[model samples]
Target: MKTKAVRLYGKNDLRLEEFELPPIKDDEILAQIISDSICMSSYKAAIQGEDHKRVPKDVSQNPVIIGHEFCGIILEVGDKWKHKFKPGMKFSIQPALNLKENPYAAPGYSFKYIGGSATHIIIPNEVMEQGCLLEYNGDAFFYGSLSEPMSCIIGAFKANYHTESGKYEHKMGIKEGGNMAILAGVGPMGLGAIDYALHADRKPKRLVVTDIDEARIKRAESLYRAEEARKNGVELIYVNTGTVSDPVKYLLDLTGGEGYDDVFVFAPVKAVVEQADKILAKDGCLNFFAGPTNPNFSAELNFYNVHYNSTHIVGTSGGNTEDMIDALRLMSEGRINPASMITHIGGLDCVVETTLHLPEIPGGKKLIYTNISMELTAISDFRKKGETSPLFAALADIVEKNNGLWCLEAERYLLENADKI
Candidate 1:
């Protein structure tokens, strides 16, 4: 089968090209990709190219497909796994396949045959054996693509902290029923963290999300309303730190000088990292959530607190299989909403440029429907644009039916009418 895909050749080189895929082997599965979400890590992979740890060593010789956060439909299932994995089943993958004890050979970054930013892809034997393939029965197909990022947020909360108290180790998660903060860059991932933090089983008493951009802070507040948080018995505060004279002092004052129990640094800026460290309370867990492209990026730390206050730092790149399962389950149960993380939608043809300039684009996740040919549209603009464009008018109807949010009906209508739009 022939399909179009975004392939990485070398550093700063990405090409959207047509290629013929080989027949699926007996142990493999063939899938038609529907929705794939662009990630910042994909931007790093495109720039770093061969230097990226996840990129295959021979990527220059054999160009690999470039995407991982995606969901698709099983087009052809191999005989060996026909019973367990049948054709026409909707599926999402936990692309961080830690197969064969290897951490670097993930689908989007390393695979030459499999990627989300393509019309179709093959599921290797390793992915199935590792049980990374998830059959999704969700309402919205975009949720399948979104589940991967949401899993990362789930893993962050699931991460355990250990403290040494005279030879006894005490382990715990984000201090249950305590104050929490997500610092800087309340973009896509930061907003995901806020949603999870507010709705998880162990909800925070006070959740504070800080961002320098006033518009972004307001957007986040609008989606995850303070009224909703109050209904959940959690105080939610959105702070535009740039407007404040002393941001750290303002954050500290919110907690009545108690400081945050868990501080998640969503920006890789050195100043933001340092600020997160300074606001840590006793036994505070500072999660460096953002990944910096620069290898030598460093920030000053208060080692005195590390020694005396039981404050520590932790960082995680992606979630595990269990975390992905937890994310899917939570979404299925309506405990958390991942759809709010998406801000833009485009087709596979636009993925190359979108991946290149992702950081410059504002709003949340940019969803790409691999089979469609459509321009990127922000969900917020559907209503206004619907006035003139009949296509957007149809979309506006779907979004309104779902309470002004993107849902399965909206995704189905968009995909069915993508070519017309």
Candidate 2:
């Protein structure tokens, strides 16, 4: 059988190409992808083409199907995987490939699961027998792809946010009470951080979000409902970096003359690194949420600032299995309106077209519907059914019932399962 994918052919090149697909291995499963949201790294690949690590020289040499964040339904299953998933079942995939137990540890990108941008994906035996991040939820849409991004965000929160430290230090560990600044372009991941920070259990006292695009900042304010984000004690501040000559000075003023307690650098801009150091409060933490492409991407830091002020800087990449699991729970429960982030929706035909214009598109998530025709549904219907899942309702109840224990527990589950899938 033949499968279609958005393949990276050369530098700044991508095409909708077809390939002969291998039969499902006995321990594997075949999935029909529902939807996929684009990530910044994918955008880089779309732009840099051959220079991108995942895009190999040629099909025979090495080939990669683009896209990482997606959700799908089980279409066919082999014997070894039949017990884990059933046909017609909807589930999210934990996209991180590193498995602690496996000898080869073939992460999906390393092997040939292809990508969510394709019409179909073949789940390898290693991924199947170990079990992927599949939750028994009917309303799950684009879970397979989204699992990776959400998991990565959960990992960031886990790495930074803590409840115990909040009560003792009067800081919310980047959750509710501490001040946070996301300095980078407001791509999808940056937008996710904004939502996560705003709706965080302990929420940040104030969230200072920035981007070079003024339109994206406006969209974040309206779509994420920043006006209504005060319940968690989160104060939303939007800054247009395009106009700001000195972001560091601007951030200090926004934080009552004190610098942000925690700053998340999302874009990897050289200036962002320097400003992050300037705008952090004493004993503050700076997280470079976005990874630099250059292998030797290093930044200069002041030792006096680090030693005397007691500041810390850290970076994180793809999340563990635990993050994906928690992300699923967060989506299932309703604390996060994951679908709300999706602004652009198209199909396989538009992958190359939309990807080419990614940097130009402002704000919200862009979804590529690989399995079905975009003509099958209208935009209005798409938006209407977006939040209709019963899981969202259930999650809303969980949020209301006992604060956010359910949410916290859901995250904890992903951490535990990170190694298994």
Candidate 3:
């Protein structure tokens, strides 16, 4: 089989090439990628190349695929896994393959033929053996692609533990009905965290999200209305910290000066991390959810609170398979709408440029259809692009009907109307 993919050759070296795929082995499965959402991690991998932990050391010769948040359909199933999987089944993969030999080896960063950027991929034996490939029954492939990122948010929530006054064992998860704050949290993953906190089983009584950008805060509020979150038993509040005189004091005042029980730092900035530390209540759990590129990233913390208030910190890189399952289940059940996370759409032809300069993009997630050939375009620009192209006109109309957010109808139209790769 032949596949077209965006491959990472070295630092800042990405090539869009068509190559022949080796025949599937007895333990391997063939898949056709439908949708893949570009991630910051992919950008880091593209820039760092061999320096990234997940990328193989000999990546210059043996290039790997460049996407991970993907979902697709099974084209062929090998004999070794015919009973468990069959042709035409939809699937999502948990890229965090914790192999003992290469602990950081993941699908998008480490593999040559199994990354999400390709039109088709060969799921290796180890993926199935490690139980990373999950069967997805969701209607939209984008939701399956989003499941991996949502799982990371879910993992952070689950990893956060609160303590009792006199108990030795730590209680898992954020405190139910407690005050929670997501600092610099108007970004894509931060939006996911807000959705989970509002709709998930464990509900926080008050949820405050902070961002320096007023535009992003407004966008997030428009997608997730405060009224809607209140109905779900959460008092959702979006604050532009840039406008506030003392952001920490203002945030603490929202919780009646008691401070927050769960504080999440979404930005890797040092000041953001310190802000999260300053607003912790007694037994508060600070979950640092951002991944920094710098190896020496550091921030000063209050040791007094650490020794007296029982405030502690925890960080998680990605979610486990079960967390991915939770994400899939939640989306399939129509409980969470991660569509709020995606801000742009494109095709396979745009992967190389987009991956190389993802940080420069202004919007949220950049979703790519691996089989199409369109350039990277923002959802906000659809109406403008519609003047010349009828395809975008129809897409803009559909997105407008869905309150200016990308929907399944938009995906159906784009894939059917756009030129195939």
TM-score of each: 0.95, 0.77, 0.99
Candidates in descending lDDT order: 3, 1, 2
Q: What stretches of model 3 exceed 4 Å from their correct place?
A: none
Which ranges in model 1 have alpha carbons more than 4 Å from their true place? 160-164, 383-388, 400-404
Highest-TM-score candidate: 3
lDDT of 1 at 420: 29
lDDT tens per residue, model 2, 1-421: 6788877655567677878888987877787776677776777766666555554445335656778776777888898766667898876666555556533233323444557778788877666545554653735465445667867876776666322323544332454477888887366787677766766565778788887777667656665566677766677888886798877777799888888778888877777788888888877788888877677887777779787876778678767776777677776676765544555545677777777677676555666667544422222343244377443344344334542222333223222332210
Cα lDDT of candidate 3 equals: 0.94
To one decimal, what is the Cα RMSD in angstroms of model 1 from the true structure?
1.8
lDDT tens digits, residue span 44-95, model 3: 9999999998899999999999899999999998999999999999999999
Q: For residue 211, give model 1's deviation from the true position in Å.
A: 0.7
- Provide the RMSD of all predictions against the true structure, rounded to 1 decimal: 1.8, 9.0, 0.7
CA-lDDT, candidates in order: 0.87, 0.65, 0.94
Q: How close is candidate 3 to the true structure, as a TM-score?
A: 0.99
